[model samples]
Target: MAKELDLIEEFRDLSLVCEVTPRSVKLGMLKLTNSFLEKVKECQKRDRKLSEKLVLIDEGKEDDF
Candidate 1:
């Protein structure tokens, strides 16, 4: 929730800095940015979980060669 609000504020500031002319275009860009950020975060979380699982497996199993 707070993260989302921070992102929204950042987008607004970016748009202001870039001098984006139209409100609709600014909004469209913001939505795309938000969606991309969410996907990246989700991927990072999944990767972390997979890494932890791999570590656990390595610790629990013994090589039989």
Candidate 2:
């Protein structure tokens, strides 16, 4: 009976640890995803600026002619 009780307690502890691990992993993944999204937004802003500059350059060349 004592051995059975010990086994049960161990199983419960293991279950709790398992539950906590997935939650931690999910939080880490969420943070990583957010960082990636921020980088994407930065790249989009840079691309927009580059496109605007290109347009200005093209307009200046037309005026030169």
Candidate 3:
């Protein structure tokens, strides 16, 4: 839960790659980087179905409020 990305931190890293997620993805984490994480993050921000469940949970919070 605490691992979720905040909007400010999310947008701050508009160019995050897969390696950047080692802390989150863990051992067998599929390597995503550059446009991959960028697009995925974008989708995670805008599109529901395309985003990961964790990202979805983060995006769903009203912390910005």
Instruction: Estimate every model's Cα lDDT from 0 to 1.
Output: 0.62, 0.55, 0.52
Q: Which pairs in model 2 have colliding backbones? A: none
**Best to worst by lDDT, what's the order?**
1, 2, 3
lDDT of 2 by residue, 1-65 (tens): 67755665665655432222422321121222488889988887789766677677788853331
TM-score (all chains, Cα) for each model: 0.26, 0.24, 0.23
Query: Which residue pairs collide in model 1, if any?
Result: none
For model 1, give the 10-residue run with minimal summed lDDT. 17-26
Predicted candidate 1 versus true structure: per-residue lDDT over 1-65, tens digit per residue? 67756766787776643333435223544333588888988887779766677677788863332
Q: Residue 19 of model 2: what lDDT?
A: 26
Please give the distance, in angstroms, between residue 62's alpha carbon in candidate 3 and its true position after superposition: 13
- Candidate 2 C-alpha error for residue 6, in Å: 24
Lowest summed lDDT across 10 adjacent residues in model 2 is found at 23-32
Model 3, TM vs. native: 0.23
- Cα RMSD to native, each candidate? 12.0, 12.1, 19.2
In angstroms, give how far residue 36 of model 1 lies from its true place.
27
